[model samples]
Target chain A: MDTAQFNEALAHIRRFETMLVEDGALILKFWLHLSKKEQYKRLKKLEKNPHTRRSVSKRDWRHAKLYDQFVKTAEQAIRQTDSGEAPWLLVEATDWRYRDLTVARTVLESLAKHLSLESAQSEITTQSKPLTPTGTLPSTLTILDTVDLSQCLRAQEYSQALETYQGQLHRLAWAAYEQKCSTIIVFEGWDAGGKGGAIRRMTQAMDARLYRVISTAAPTDEERVHHYLWRFWRHIPRAGRVTIYDRSWYGRVLVERVEGFAKEKEWQRAYLEINDFEEQFAKHGNVVIKFWIHVSQDEQLRRFQEREKIPYKKHKITDEDWRNREKWDVADLLVKKMAQLPEQTKN
Target chain B: MDTAQFNEALAHIRRFETMLVEDGALILKFWLHLSKKEQYKRLKKLEKNPHTRRSVSKRDWRHAKLYDQFVKTAEQAIRQTDSGEAPWLLVEATDWRYRDLTVARTVLESLAKHLSLESAQSEITTQSKPLTPTGTLPSTLTILDTVDLSQCLRAQEYSQALETYQGQLHRLAWAAYEQKCSTIIVFEGWDAGGKGGAIRRMTQAMDARLYRVISTAAPTDEERVHHYLWRFWRHIPRAGRVTIYDRSWYGRVLVERVEGFAKEKEWQRAYLEINDFEEQFAKHGNVVIKFWIHVSQDEQLRRFQEREKIPYKKHKITDEDWRNREKWDVADLLVKKMAQLPEQTKN
Candidate 1:
């Protein structure tokens, strides 16, 4: 899409009122129009007036010359978006008074019509629920059930396997650097499921200078200023390097969803947003690896009890961990529903 | 040491002129004094004045009550630091004009004496070298000679050895984390000396989230605003994490020294400063590891040639690399001399 078309589409998508229009909500848009001659005359007047001269620039004249092109694109946008629930009102802006009056009349007329329709609908179905449809997940079964919690590796076998994998990973990491390929590994798991241990196993085989481990925690003041994903984007590895994330953006769907930290609509829309984000990574030819270390509820409890007896490990087991355990089933259900999201989102 | 004695020692050490006092340089020191009653009287006057009210605070009043203690410490500092060349000129600061006049006269007298001495010395030693002594290294031999370049590992042995070490490092890293011990690893080496390779081996065994590799390059505008060491200090890993430096602050003494980027005296004094810096790390129970990869001149040349023939590696072989190779002997001599510094400095 051209710049103008893209900007118009972005504006539409960003406006919550525009989205609501699709659900039969009233939304009236006004397009103020001025002819090329009228725009140039106004520009000249602005330049001549000392009060407005500072606001005028060379770019103003430059864009004025392309007024026809802008009008064509804007007209196309209006036609495409014009609908019964969200109608566009075109007002000729050559005269300020006429433009203002037309815009005011259009808004008042739309509001009156919407109010009348709402009143009639309320009278006809006073006992019925509102007809807003909520989107449903594709699956209800928790993916946690599929994990074989009983699976365990003997200490000796685990050591041997770790050695083999580390050796291979060491070589592969160098090859990746030589080939200018970047890799990102994401670790998300249940409490005390050995995510840190597994991550350590992979990093042990790589060069200290070639990878960075980002342990996600509460967002800093600077991070909170931007979109939630901005912090993650800022740490994306440079070419031929690796970035490993502990926990990750999935908290928006998992913990945030279960804890009601995010609104229902916000978490529901995050699935598509996350998919688009990962799609960009795939497009950039980055290798994305994700792991969910699964462990049984009994094992987690046993570990927590064991941690309480160890001085160094005691801090890792907190009252908050115990509180979170109480909501395991709720989290489990939400996670399973999230698992039904397209696998492509994990990339 | 008490605060007053500490400041006196700090001032003496920080001033190059003070150090040169033994060499017959004329140095003047100043110690401003005010009685407890006089200071409190002035502070009250300042507080009552609108122009100085902004500077007054509860802390100032609290400190005012300690005026007698401060006076005792100041007198002790002045007596301890009294020297023939850099004599302390104590001025009663209760009266501003008297204090200013005393300071000005002291500086003027010292400057006159210094000028006359310099003129006399120049006349007497027209052909003789100055008596200032330069600190010399203990030896002229390059430490590179101590490295056995003939050392090599076969492919199979290298793989097996790498796995064993990686496993050990992995466990140690976790232990360090649990114990809240930070680790710093410094890498320095000749071109094609496999610094990157060795670093990769060590990092591969670590958890990706527990370590960060910092590759030093030219300082950015922000970095240039602070001391050269500030950049390195800013990246020091938090508790339980590892920070690996590809090259480090040693550049102030190494590359900057040989390349004439730093003055002779600057690099000369860096030894003590760096020693103190590393001593702090040791005191904090942080593990510090340093490595210097050694490669024979012939081996480096062969590797450079090999890199030039490989498509991906060719970019690593540049004209700058060739130029640096030409100064190998000079760099080798300087590096060996630096190695003679106390072992604590290396850590």
Candidate 2:
């Protein structure tokens, strides 16, 4: 909000404007803002609500007090940087009705600017769309929801299949490297549902020279200071390389939203922010694959017990898991909401 | 070494062993290995006389040839996966004596032992060793002797100085990107001078973010085929960084040398055997900068004229500038010898 910070933000916006002019790509940013009183009240209500009481932490309450300063800073930053080419749309998150409507309108506007409604209609006419035939696009069974344990291989067979897949990935990686093509794969699912295990297996076959595995954790100090998208931008592979994200930017919507780690406004605006990020990746000629490993609550509990018993793996079991479990119904509702999101809306 | 097939001759050494399990601190690597023919020639020639035919391409002949394959492969790979703990060393290019001596001594000695040298040394000596003044250390000017520039500005005039620097660099660059915490600067210099204008102004007001600039040209195609680094490994910055190079690894030693690109034996060892590559950057953290801007002899003449164009600039142009001009006579003599190196060694 100071003069120097404002100028720096303006310079960044100008650079993006130049890119938009040259590349024919429009840049859109959204701010999800919640007032301090509203945020505190929401947390207080959550703590008092018997069903959701345990999920509200002392730390979260502390953050809620400083929510005013956070919003003020965000407002000034947006005002200073917003321009004709890329303007910031602020979402009022105190009311869900206002929030979702604002998001849908902003998205429709940006999409319209990128691809006019007339053009979209013409494209739709040209493109064949799929029909939901019976179980083809099941409402009850998602790609995550259908991860059957019975279909999994025995230990020996698992190793063999893993080796084969790893080899395939490795050769594919080398081919990509030799051809200077880049690839990005995203893994997301229920915690402890073999996401890391599957990733380790996939990486095993790659030529140490061709691929990298990036694990996303809590935002670092530097990462917290920048836009949420900024940290993800740093990992895009150069020509002829591959990058794998264990958990990805979707945390902004998933854990951050359901767990109250991010403000309602921030997570609410993330759908479009994420879509924009993926759009950029596609434009950059990267082959992107997203996998969501779904595990049932029963399976999650079994793994949680296993982690507690194992000495080395004990560190991975955090108090957060127990807390998240307390609001499984809410998390489930959010995940279902995320699942229903149109493919084009949030890649 | 035929004109049509000149690039293929860059294949020289096959596999490069660049890693070692050394004392705890992973020492970075730069391997400068020379073949027996080249080694014998140097030992025999040096024994007979102090002066041997100095070839321009010969300086990087071996590096360029070996660079193409190994360096590129190595750079593309994440080294930690290959060896669980130890980091690989990037072997740099040099004469046979230097290459062999470094490998046999520093690299091997560091690799074989698990002892922490620093801690052990500290334990042995209660007080740190004081610097004993040698009869005389090499003058600071010799280190900077390669630079050829007319002017420099001080920190007090930073705004004007920054404007000039940014303007000159913007004009010089073909492409630019600002990634999080990394900036890459690339420069291509001549055999000696012509690098001053770019290097002299680059280091001022550098950010804590890792900034690296690589200069490239004239390595064997064999060097070309392997890893991208088969030539530039020694210069990568590990953390928040900045690196500048005098000359980079493009030599499969041909353009000015015989065989049109580089001779058979002289530049033969580089192609598929280079060790430095993309993986290093992909796996590690740093911003990469690569530049190759060289002045022609005529431009050199103009620049020298301009240097002495005013009384204030007269001090900038020196006898060394004239001496380097004279060295090109020696340069041509060396070029002839380089033209014959490949056939002489291989045959």
Query: lDDT per residue, candidate 2, B1-347, as tens digits?
Result: 35333322222110233222221245444545444456556555644542223222354445545655644554544342234343445444445566667667865676555456556755764432221223122323231234454555677798687777766554233122233333334454443345656576664434323345555534444445444443466565544345666554434332323223333333334432322333234324444554545344676777788878788778868886675565443333333333333221111
Q: In candidate 1 chain B, what residue range of length 10 has the lowest lDDT sum?
A: B126-135
Model 1 TM-score on chain A: 0.63
Off by over 4 Å in 1: A1-347, B1-31, B42-58, B75-90, B100-143, B153-184, B201-214, B218-243, B260-277, B280-287, B345-347
lDDT of 1 at A92: 90
**TM-score of the B chain in each candidate versus the native B chain:** 0.65, 0.33
How many Å off is the CA of B204 in candidate 1? 5.0
Per-residue alpha-carbon lDDT of candidate 1 for residues B1-347, written as tens digits (9 for 90 to 100): 67765875545444434445533456678888777788788889978975446457899999888887777776776776676766888788988999999899889988988889888966764332211213244445555567776788899998998898888888788778779999999999888888888888888888887899999987765576556677898889899999999989888887787676665655667776666666667657798888888888899999999999999999888998898898786677677877777677333
Q: Which stretches of candidate 2 lie over 4 Å from their true place?
A: A1-149, A345-347, B1-347
The true-versus-predicted C-alpha distance at residue B5 of model 1, in Å, is 12
- State each model's C-alpha RMSD to the native: 34.9, 25.8
Provide the lDDT at A86 for model 2.
75
User: Looking at candidate 1, what TM-score does chain B attain?
Assistant: 0.65
Worst 10 residues of 2 chain A by lDDT: A128-137
lDDT of 2: 0.58
lDDT of 1 by residue, A285-325 (tens): 78888788777778889998998999999988899999888
